[model samples]
Target: MRYVTTAGVIALALGLSACGAGGNDSAAANGSPFGDCIITGEAGSSPLNLISDGVVTVKADLPSPGWYNGDTVESIKSGFDYCLLANIAHRGGAKGLNLQNSSFDGLVAGKAGSFDMALNQITITPERESVMDFSDPYYESTAGVLVKKGSTLTQSDLADSHLGVKQGTVGQMLVDKTIKPAKAPAVFPGDAEQQAAVAAGRIDAGIQDLSIVLGASVQSGGKLTVVGQIPTHESYGVMMPKGSANVVAVNKMLKEMKDDGTLDKLNSTYLTEAYGVDPTTIPVWSF
Candidate 1:
């Protein structure tokens, strides 16, 4: 799972605050003050970034390198190049370039034309698909519950427990609708905080992406453990402006990555260390 930054939230809130500021003048001149294309995504996760007017901007909350086997900064640099290689090695490949180093200030400064694409652990939904074009899913994950090691909670005990979850995530939604705990679920901005809440016993358990929970648990040295699995499905995709020409180019390269086993190899190298399970072993979603 990806992380969200306080700055992004502030920016979004500010945008909403200014929605009626200029009105007709803003609308008739540049078309919209918000017309400047910007990509918004979970921060700190290696697999996503915000692109503004074609410039890549890093988010403030970068994921820790220990989360995956190939999560080193150097490995990320190399793995990102796979997108470029796919373009050169395959027909209709899209070109991608590294920009900022996953920082909020860097992204705001880099904003400029059409943000070619933004990739993160963005869940695909009919409402979103209606407004943006998305590449084939790059990763699949499920919602899961985590508790501290030696905690009394069991897989069958969480139906009545208070849960911690990142707001707006599938995990939170699942817990809200399925578990329906009496107390309102504690909401945090990112996985790190939710994990921390579980470790501190502030919350009886946490609901998050399985991969994120596994990675956090491994990094925490057995401080956390999976209590139960939430029956929710989610996947990640690369988002581009609807009907943009770059869509075809990006999809072509992604298809090549899929065909040449590069995607699988990357996942095997990174996800295995994080989740202690091969993503390939998971059943594919049939849509």
Candidate 2:
């Protein structure tokens, strides 16, 4: 089963400490907060939609990229996306759900107007918890290093190699806190940019989430390989308004989804079995 880690337990304690500050503004004076749950993600892209009649319907012109297959809504609605959707539908308390395009800054800070919940692979950290509430982790991931095939780069070389990491990501944090490369890390705009830089030989290695780097290795067609994985505690949670009563309800649904094997099926179909990467077989590198 998916149990919260030690770090997550501390986070929950800290979150409880702030209870004196009061619950989310959306909360009802009587108790629970239930209404039209507004789901949001970065603008210029459709990150969520309602599935109807076996077809995923999008509110925008483009569709959310849920998996490696395509940007089509149907193609993208597996894994975490499906887990979140299935839980919400199974819970059945909210008046309705609506999708809105928003800014990352706004969503991370829980100030994205009109949005009750936010998703999009956002990581939960203590700093962010001071301002927002996070649901139980839907995805657990670790840092992974991607390198050119047959490049013979060892774990020891990682500390001195020219590493590439995306700005404002956990990969960059891992590099700073654990890898400590001799030279400065080559910062890129995002995962795509960092992967491209590694592919072009602009950097010695690319550091990112295991799923991302593993997918890169598969798509590279024998050009790239995941050299190692960092043993770190990291998970993605649904961000919600701070002190929102919905947090409890959402967590319950997430746990139910996990217990019933729904989450395992989705992960197997979209990530583990489909990607052909044995997470256990991936070599572990410590900090």
Candidate 3:
């Protein structure tokens, strides 16, 4: 896991703590029952704890099933997840939010009937929209490939190469639907396996989120380099069951966060500040 250092976390925490409640109509001002922000559901319907304190306690799913925090077991921290946490903290302070770890299969299978939110870069699509309520996109992503530094791979030649991607990720979708590799692409179970394959010379390149791949590249000790961004227009959203009670409140908070520049600050703190990758520097390609 290419995670942020302890200093990064501390700095981010302090920065958020210093944020002033600015939006004209905050979640609290909207008369939301859940909290000053969104309400996932009524008491017991979701992980949100209904209490007199008016704080929202939510159980959010991990990036994938069985995934745990790399930095702390008591927390579900990741570069991507950290962005979400930072935004929430900036908007209403951490006191109003409580996050619990869960899995992809659990959320999708309804195993986490009590969980309130599932984020982990979950893309918002019309198909998923039919069964789930999604907040306005918290993050937008583009696919990217990681290759051995100095390697001569390019987007145009990807179709003839053996690319690696996680089995059920959008990277896999990009490879299958767009890149359309000449040879069957090497499918790994997760980022670790796919990254390992790239490092071990088992695969020519690995495809995944540009931000993720860039983080991996920086942590690769010069063994890997990001190829560039693939323009797939992927937007990641926070999800809840269909007709989630908190959708309105959540969307309200999200909109305020966007308008207040909290989202951009979070993006910089986690992605660029921690990983040192300038997203704009990466070239973008269209399928």
Q: Largest lDDT belongs to which candidate? A: 2
Query: Model 3 lDDT vs. the true structure?
Result: 0.55
- Cα miss at 215, model 1 (Å)? 0.2
Q: List residue ranges in candidate 1 displaced over 4 A.
A: 1-61, 64-96, 99-114, 277-287
Q: Is candidate 1 or candidate 3 better by TM-score?
A: 3
Q: Tens digit of lDDT per residue, candidate 1, span 99-155?
A: 222321122223322445544345555546776677766655565567899988765
- Per-residue lDDT for 1-287 in model 2, tens only? 87432211111000000111112122223332311222222221222222332222112111223321223322222334433543463353332323344434445655665445666556777767899889889777677788988788888888989999866567887898778889999987556667778888889999876766776777678888888888668787877777665677667666766787666555544444434456667788887
Query: Candidates' lDDT values, in order?
Result: 0.47, 0.56, 0.55
Order the numbered candidates by TM-score, best leading: 2, 3, 1
Where is model 2 more than 4 Å wrong at Cα?
3-69, 72-79, 94-114
Off by over 4 Å in 3: 1-70, 75-98, 103-113
Q: Look at candidate 3 and give me any clashing residue pairs.
A: 27-36, 28-36, 39-246
How does residue 160 of candidate 2 score in lDDT? 86
Q: Look at candidate 3 and tell me the lDDT of residue 219.
A: 63
